[model samples]
Target: MSFLTFGVGPSKLSAETAQDLRNAADLQIAEISHRSQAFAEISRRALGGLRTFLRIPDSYHILYTSSASEAMELTIQSTVELASFHFAQGKWSQYFADIAKHFRRRVLIDTVEWGQKNDFRNTFVPTEADLITICHSETSTGVACDLADIRAVRHRFPSTFLAVDGTSIMGAVAVDIALADIWLFSVQKCFGLPAGLGVMIVHERVFERAADLIARGVHNPGVFNLPAMFTMVQKDCNTVATPNVLGIYLLAQQMERWNAQCTMESRERETREKAELLGRAIEKSSSFRFLVRAPEDRSPTVCCVRSDPQTITSLHALCRAQGIELGKGYGKLKEETVRIANFPAITCGDIQRLLQVLEHVRSRTPAA
Candidate 1:
């Protein structure tokens, strides 16, 4: 059975993107040499489109990686010589902390309850921390750390390198790049592309930090640190290894259209509307409610719903029957929560159609 869902990601692609994919295959674009000008053009347009779409400043350069997790590792290993601080609100944020731990860097974390937003007003980051890792959107719990709160952290610790993980909301949300030194996310999640490709938007200061780490004889981050990657990217818009050329091609094509027909502002607005539509439907349902109760804390691109195991089972079965296969909950919340993606690829009518199915299976009893 074939299912058509655009939620979360490897989200379903639109007809236009599907055509682009087909065109790539027919033209044998993947067989081209990575060192050739053909691939450089692809990387150039993709990076340029990303800059325009995300409103990144001239001071920052976007580099390619295999995934956001790799970006996390590279970021920490590259910049954090002494210690790194994290705002841990969910699994993914904590995972970033764990990555820093792997490098033997001292990790200081300010944590909030699961599925809740980190309160930055009274938060304290140690002055000793050289890097700050903040997950702009937590995919695990559908929690979004608002950009304003991010600005608070930036204002408080201007000297520390602020790295943000915008995995679930990058393309769907409008992010002012000046808020962080490093902003990275997967192309799969919000950019409506196939998985295995990531983009790391990094400020020149991050590379400076890496250079400082090296000059001090403290520790060399390794072969493909941010500065190294930046150097290779400068030679040609290419990675040290053979990259996801197809994904890059598709992204370049998609970004061109996005920049033309739909700006980040319009997409962000639509994402909020779709997320609100899903949240309201969940609120109206008897069987489920948002895992994140506070409206502002909820994500504009990922919707997490909590319900009993039995109801969850029924919902899945029902959704699957309609070829709208819903994803199971994440990690420890596996039996309790349902995660739905509200990406740009998925239209408003599609969500409403899913809501109709949701309405039918909802429990008659009021949610507690």
Candidate 2:
């Protein structure tokens, strides 16, 4: 039987995206040389589509990496000279900080409890750290950092470079690209595309930082470092190495469709509506409630529910039996929470079906 899984990713792709993949294969997009004019045109179109979709500033340069994790690594390696500060609220944010520490950078992490907001406004970032990272949406606990808080942090530390991981909310929610000096996301989450491609937006100040580091003979550690990647993006909109050409093509097609059919504003509105619908259902149910208590702090894209371990496992199995899949909780909450993807690709009807199944499951089983 066909199934609809709400797992974070690889999420469902649209019909147009599926068709675009076939068309790319028919046209032999994967076989073309990365340096060829055809591939260059594809790269250019993809970059243009992303820039238009995200409202990226002219001062920022866009580059491609293999994944969001790689983007985090690249930002840490290329930008941080001695130390970096991170707002570690959940698994993903902590993971990013771990990457920096792995590189031997003196990493200072201000951690918040899971499912709570990080009030960065009052928090002081050390002057010794040159880079600060924030995950705009934490997939693990369904917690999202407020944009106003991010702006406040930027104002407090004007000289420190800011990086944001917009992994789960990029396409589904409205984002202010200028809030952070560097912003990155993978296509697998909100973009509803296959995995293996990440997009990074770097402001001019970040480029300057990389240049200064290079001039000082502080070489970036990774093979696909920012300076080399920036050089290629400037040259022909290509990557520092061979890229997932098909992924780029698919992303470009989806962006064009989104621009034509559902504007980002409409998408964000729908996402909020769906999230509220799910949130209310969870709140009313005896078996489940939102993992993140504050309504304002809850993620619009990934809605996580807290329940007893048996209930969560039974709900997972019941949903699967009905050909509907729900995401298991991540990290410390793995045994007691269930994650639901509220991405643009998941339609209102799909959500209604999910809720119906959830209600049926809850009614049949006693809350443990």
Where in model 1 is the C-alpha error above 4 Å?
364-366
Maximum-TM-score candidate: 1
TM-score of each: 0.97, 0.96
RMSD of 2: 1.6
What digit string (tens of lDDT, one per residue) describes model 2 on residues 202-308? 99888778878877877544557777888898998888778998898888788777777876688889999898888888877888878888899998998988877
Per-residue CA lDDT of model 1 for 9-76, tens digit only, reads 67878778889999999989999999999999998999989989998899999999999999998888
- Can you list the residue pairs that collide in candidate 2? none
> Clashing residue pairs in candidate 1, if any?
8-341
- Local distance difference test values of all predictions, in order: 0.87, 0.86
What TM-score quantifies how close candidate 1 is to the native fold?
0.97
RMSD of 1: 1.4
Per-residue lDDT of 122 in model 2 = 85
Candidate 2, position 214, lDDT: 74
